[model samples]
Target: MTLLSLSGVSFAYAAGKTVLHGIDLAVRDGGNLGIVGESGSGKTTLLKLLLGLERASAGTVSFRGAPLDARDRGFMLGFRRSVQAVFQDPYSSLDPRQRVSDIVAEPLRSLKIGTDIAEAVAQALRDVDLPPDAAGRYPHEFSGGQRQRIAIARAIVARPALIVADEVVSALDLTTRTRIIDLMRALSTRTTFVVVSHDIALVALLCERLVVLEKGRIVEEGATREILARPSHPYTQRLLASTPRMPARG
Candidate 1:
């Protein structure tokens, strides 16, 4: 079953520059997919299109076979509640003025879910393995890793069915990155994820399927093992070659 799909989607900037051209992609329900390419490969633009943050220049974006449109108000609201996102910069994505609890509760409050905001906030913090007392602190009070964890907590508190993690771990340290990746995998039991990144090796480690984009189009896609072991496209090979190998451990 396809949970989210982009069929013949295309998008262009106001300057008349095309970013994505005739792209087609589908993510199976509960599957983890990684979209990888160099900068300016239209990966982020594709994410925006998926989120409906930007409209498609052509073609259609459907969620569970239903087209996302204003007429589908109830469906759009449900979809928004079901599909969440965690962006690249945790520090910037969070509001500096808001306390951790408030930040996590914003969605619940906005959506008028009628749940106890305090309890929902507490549960979200606990799910992310954050200390209960941690909720009282502001975003400035936490380290980079902790901040990213807070971001993750906020994304999951809504109990979203699908998550678009756009380079969520790109700026973290190796240890922190590994922990977040593991957290993401654990979270996948409840939600599907679309992880977009430039690091082929990291994507290989975290995702089951890989889609390699080049100049706004998909050049290669396959099982992670197949693409990593035997890349067919020159662009895919270049990305593989450019990826640094991890040091061997004794």
Candidate 2:
């Protein structure tokens, strides 16, 4: 079943300059979709629209066939609980002063999911392979990969149906990047993921389908194999060419 759908979506900044036009995309339940494009391609904007952080200038964005409007407090709260976001920078996204447990428990408190705050935080840390004691430590104590794992754990703590992972692994080192990607793949068995990234190979490794964007338009999209093996669109080809190659395993 389709968990999220965007139809004929268009968005423009003030002064009538359109950034996205006639965009249509659907993400199935538990689907891993990777959206790739150059810096100005509106990938992040699409994510904002999905998260209800920004409304579409035109067209509609829906979840479970129902429109997503942040004005409805009930729906907004429910959406926030069911749909979560793990931002690009873990260090920036988290509060430096707060302990790890409080950071993970913030969503539950805000959404008022349940009273078992301690249990929720503990299970979340464990789900991401973080030690129970790690919950008491601050963000500074963990490495980059570990911090990102905490971020992911925070996203899923409420049992969100969909998680918008915006560049969740981009800032990590190559070794950390691979490990985090593996962790994400393992986690997707339960929660849906919309992985926003510009790295073709990273997306190729993680996503089931690919959406190639250029200048705010979807230039091409298809199964991961087709897009990677023979990228038809010029923009897609450029993205693939620009990727830094990692040494093949022996």
- Worst 10-residue lDDT window, candidate 2: 241-250
Which candidate achieves the best TM-score against the true structure?
Answer: 2
Clashes of 1: 0
Q: How many residue pairs clash (N, CA or C atoms closer than 3 angstroms) in each of the candidate models, in the order given?
A: 0, 0
TM-score per model over all chains: 0.95, 0.96
Pairs of residues clashing in candidate 1: none
Tens-digit per-residue lDDT, 1-250, candidate 2:
9988999999998888899999999999966888988899999899899888999999999988989987899988888988999999987888999999999999999999886999989999998999999989999999989999999989999999999889888899989998998888888889888889888777877788889989999999988877777889888888878886432111
Which residue runs does candidate 1 get wrong by more than 4 Å? 245-250
Find the candidate with the highest lDDT and give its number.
2
State the C-alpha lDDT per candidate. 0.87, 0.88
Q: Residue 130 CA error for candidate 2 (Å)?
A: 0.9
RMSD versus native structure for model 1 = 2.5
Write one digit per residue (lDDT tens) for candidate 1, span 45-132. 9999888788898999999998878467788788889788999998899999988999999878776677878988899899888999
